[model samples]
Structure formats: C-alpha cells, structure tokens
Target: MSLAVVTLKKGEGRLLKSGGMWIFDNEIASVMGSFVNGDIVLVHDFDGYPLGRGFINTNSKIVVRLLSRDENTMIDEEFFEKRVWDAWEYRKKVTDTSSCRVIFGEADFIPGFVVDKFSDVLVVQSLALGIDRYKEMLVELLKKVLAEDGIQIRGVYERSDVKVRKQEGMEPYKGFIGEEFSTLVEIVENGVKYQVDVKDGQKTGFFLDQKYNRLAIQKLCKNARVLDCFTHTGSFALNAGYAGAKEVTGVDASQLAVDQATANAALNGLSDTVKFICEDVFDLLPALEEKGEKYDVVILDPPAFTKSRSSIKNAVKGYREINLRAMKLVKDGGFLATCSCSHFMDYELFTQTIGQAAKNVHKRLRQVEYRTQAPDHPILWSADESYYLKFYIFQVCSDR
Candidate 1:
C-alpha cells in the first residue's frame, strides 16, 4: 500500500526542522493521502519537501511521531532491530547495562514506548497507537540484541495500563507479554537490594530514573538524621540507611508502599535504622513541625505534580509548599535534597520555586550540587520531554 502523505502548513515545520520528533495536529495543513490512525505516513513541508516518516494518529494531539528523517529509510523489522541495538550499545557506554532503562520512548528514537530491563526481566509500556504495533517486534529484537552480549532476558512483561493509552484510542492492558515467570523481580543498585513487584507496583514497579540521584544523596547522610518524603518503596531511605545515617524515616501515603519499603529495609538488614510510615506527607509534616521535628537531611522525591502545561501554575504551588516545609525542617547547616519529576515543571521554574521557598522560610541556601536523571535515561537535546527530573542538593542555614 502506498504511504499517505501529511503536509504541514507553512512555517509549521520549524519544530521538526529544529530536530524535534513531534508534530501537533494543528500544524498539519492537510492530509492528501488516505491513512487511518496508527498508520505510517510521510510528512512534508508546505512546499512539498519530504520532512520524514512518522506514525499518524488523528485521535492524539501529537498528530505525528517522526520515526525517520530519511525519505528512503524503510520502517521495517530491520530498522527496529538496529534502533534497539543502538539504544543498548549506548547504554553499555554510559550506564550499568545489567539493569537500567534500555529504551526511553522518544529519546531512544522509539516514540511512545518505554522498556526497562531488571536483571533477567524486561518491563515494557507502549503508550502511542503507532508504537504499540511494533512493541512485540521491538521486544524480540531487544532480547536478540541482549543475547548477543551474553545477557539472557528470561521473560517479558507489559505494563501498558496507563491513562495515556486511552488518549491513543486503545484500551489499557497489563500482564506477561510472553511466558509468565515469577513477577517478583530482584534488582541491585549501588549495592542495595530491592524486590520489584513488576505485576502491581508504580510505573514499571520501580523508578529507575532516580538511580543516580539516590546515590548522590548518600554522601550527605553519614551519621545524619534523614527524612525521605514520598519515598516510594523507600529507595532513597534505604540508600541513606546503607550510608550509615543515624536514623532514616520514609513517609508515603500508600500503606502498600510502606509495607514494601519495610520489607526492602529488612531485605538489606537496614530495618534497625530505617523505618517506613504510612501517612499523608502534608499532614505529617505539619505535625512534625508542631513537635519541633528536625532532620539533618530532608529528601523530597515526589511524583510529578503536574503532567500537562496547563497545570504548571498549580504545580508550582505544590512544589513550593513542600520545599518550604522541607527547608524549615532542616536544622542549621543541615542538607536538603529536593527534586521534581515533572517535565512541565521546567528547570528555571523549579529552581525559582525553591528559591522562593527558602526566602519564605527565611532560610539561607548554600548550593551543594545539581543533578538530573541517570545517564541511562538520556535527555536528547531539543526534545524537552526527554529532560525531566530536576534534583538539587542544598545546605540550609538560619537567616537569624
């Protein structure tokens, strides 16, 4: 079948010309060829210049997700195999390939699909209509490529039960993609052990993006009283405990998370110094303040407060509130590590929010360091979505 051609309005190809991979529906001037949702179509500038080939979905605001810029490039099995291999080879150089984000959606040149390898297991999330069609092929290619490196992927699990799937005109799905093995997968990072519940845990059962950020907080935790907020499964708390912190408190609203976190602490034999509490952080923080609670190190690794651009204003308030409370809880000369995982919460805005919080609390902040997601999750330049997660380590002092 002849591929459909999608022509963009004049001046609308600037984003694509600037190396971005997304084409908004509004930018499209007209559709000359017949192609349904999830079909591979050729994109062209108003002057009929071939821009690229992408998956088209009229249902999505992101009308087209460019897969290749070359007009002659074939979007076939071999293409995916090379893309997967390239992604894997890149990970080998910059990150621990044993277990890390092997493919990060658009950043990996595979738009709307995410793949995380945990030990011998692979967890995938296919979000876009077009990418969903090639997910199985990508998985097979990934296994083949990894096998070349002598690493065996025993099973593949799909965690496609995300709300975003609905936006793509597909029902959410979850379960094993192929042979079902024990869903309980164990992965070790920075020498700490964790049992990831790939079947029913948050976002692929673990937040591997924060792998290095958690490690970055270890140096400030020795003999310090540490408080980790929104400590999903207690990754940061465990790191603090393993770093020889005097005491570590991990707070989460979900009891299941607290239970899992407690078990994780026991798994590493850090339960003696680490504890998990099930309570709303907002409510708990105020009570702790009333009790004059203070910690030598406070870590805020909250989920994305805002997913879309429209909610950035409200997200700023949420970020500022938590940061203000966290800063107040830090004793003089104490360290505070705070981060926002929302891409909508841009770097400059997040830093400004933190600065405002410090000022509101009348605290002086001595910048320690700044970091982002682990190198494994590469942030492709010009692709703003590739860059989320802003982490800052600061020493808080009393203005008085």
Candidate 2:
C-alpha cells in the first residue's frame, strides 16, 4: 500500500531541518492520500523533496514526529528491535543499568515515549498519540532486549497519566502492562536505597536523573552541618548522612514526602544524624534565617517553578528567592548545591538569576562545578527540551 504524503509549507520546517523530530501543525502545507492519525506517512519539502517518514496526528500542535530519517526504512518489528537494542546498549555504557532511563523520548529517537528501568521492573510513559499505539510493542521489545543480557523483567507498569496526553486527544491511563505485582519497588543509587511507588508516586515513582548530582555533594558534607530544602524522599540528605555529616535536616511541605524521607533515613541507619521536617520550604527558609541558624552545606532541589514560557518571569523570581535564602543559610566558606529542572529556564537565564541572588545577599560565590541530568538521560542537541536540568555547586563566601 502507498503511504500518505505530507508536504511542508515554505520555510516552515526550520526546526525539523535543524535535526528536530517534530513538525508543528502550522508547518505543513498539505496532506495527500488517505490515512488515519498515527499512521506512518511520507514527509516532503515544499519543492517535493523527500524528507522522511513520521507518524501524523492533527490533534496535536506537534503534527508529525519523525521516526526514521531514511526515506526507505521500514517501520516494522525489525526497526523497533534495533531502536530498543541501541538504547539499551547506550545506557549500559554510560550509566548503571540496574536502574536508569532506558529510552529518553526524542533523545533516543523514539519521540514522545519514555521507558525507565527500576531494578527488575519497567515503567513506561507515553505522551503522544502517535507513539501511544506502539507502547505495548515497545514494552515487549524492551523486555526481549533486556533478557538478552540475562536480565529478567518481572513486571511492567504504565504511568501515562500526565496532562500532556490531553493535548494528544487521549485520556490519561495508569495500570499494569502485564500481570500485577507489588507496586512498591526498591532501588539503590549512589549507595542510597529508595522504595519507589510505581502505582501512585510522582512521575515514575522517583527522580533518577539526579542520581549523580546527589553523589557530587557527598565530599563536601563530611563532618559538616547540612540543610536539604525540598528534599523529596531524602535522597540528598541520606547521602549526606551516609557521608558522615555532623547533622542533616531535610525539609519539605508534603507530609507524605517527609514521612517517606524519614523512613528512608531509618532504612539507611542514619535516623540519628538525619531528620525530616514537614513545612513549606519558602516559609521555613525565612524563619530559619530569623533564627540565625547556619549550615556548612545547603542544598536546594526545588521542583520546576515553571512549565511554560509564559510563566518564566515568575519562575525566575522563585528560583532567585530560594537561592538567596539558601545562600544566607550557608556559613561563610561553606558549600551550596542548587539546581533548576525546568527546561524553559535556560542556562543563561538561570545563571543570571543565581548571580542576582548572590549580589542581593552580598555573597561572593566561588564556582565548584556545573552539571546537568545524568548521562542516561542524554541531551540531544537541537531538541532543547531534553536538557532540562542545570545543577551547580559553589563555595559561598561572605563579602569583605
């Protein structure tokens, strides 16, 4: 059967031409041939030049997500098996495979779908309708690929309940992909153990992208007082305790998070030195400032303050305020670890915001190092969304 042809409007596919996978709704000039949404279609330039093959969906602003740049490539079982094999091999080389992102959406060349491995289990999230149809096949293929390495996947779960699915004209969904199993799964990273709730916890149960960033702060925490703000599940605080920090206090507004963090502290046998508090970080930071409490190391790992371009101004203010307060809480010559997970908050803008915060507090920052999301979450150039995390470590010094 002949495939449908989608031709782009003149000068409208700049992003796609620049190695991006998406063709926005306004970029296409015409669709020739009959096909349903999610069917693979041939894409062409305005001059009738063959571009590639991609799945089309009029329901999304991102109308087409390219699957193969080779015009002759077939989108069959063989094609998907290679994609799975390649993604798995890349992770084994760059990150610890026990628990890590196996496929990172567009970065791994599988647009709008993500698969994360947690111990012997798999969690899949599909955000695009075009990819949604292939979710089960990809999951099965992933299992087959992992089994090649002698790894047995015990269960597969789906966490496609994100709001973005609505944009694709699909309803949110969550449940087991295969046979039901215990939803509570434990995984270790940087020597810290966590109980991941795959059924109900936030965004695939845990934030694995910060795996290395959490490890980076351990050297600075030994025998020092540490404060971890927005310490969800106590990953950083426990790392500090594991490093022999004199005292560690982790604060978060969610009582459930605080409870889990406290349990994790006990799980690591650090309950004596590490503690958790349930309170608003924004409110608690000011009260702690008033109390004149200081710490040798302060870590701020707040959730993304913005998810869209329109709210970037407010996100800037939020990042600046939290950073300024956290800096004040750090004693002179002490360490500070801060990060922003919002991709909309670009590197330049985030750095400028932190600099403004330091200036406002009369603190001079000596750069320690800068990092981004873990290697498993590879950042594909031209697809800026893949590079969301920006982490920085610094030595906070009092101005003379």
Q: Score every model by TM-score.
A: 0.99, 0.99
Q: Give residue 242's error in model 2 in angstroms.
A: 0.7
Q: Residue 125 in candidate 1 has what lDDT?
A: 96
Which runs of model 1 end up more than 4 angstroms from their true locations? Answer: none
Per-residue lDDT of model 1, residues 261-364, tens digit only:
99999999999999999999988887899899999999999999999999999999999999999998999999999999999999999999999999999999
- Give the poorly placed runs of model 2, Cα more than 4 Å off: none
The Cα error of candidate 1 at residue 252, in Å, is: 0.2
lDDT (Cα, 0-100) at 223 in candidate 1:
99
- Per-model CA lDDT versus the true structure: 0.93, 0.94
**Colliding pairs, model 2:** none
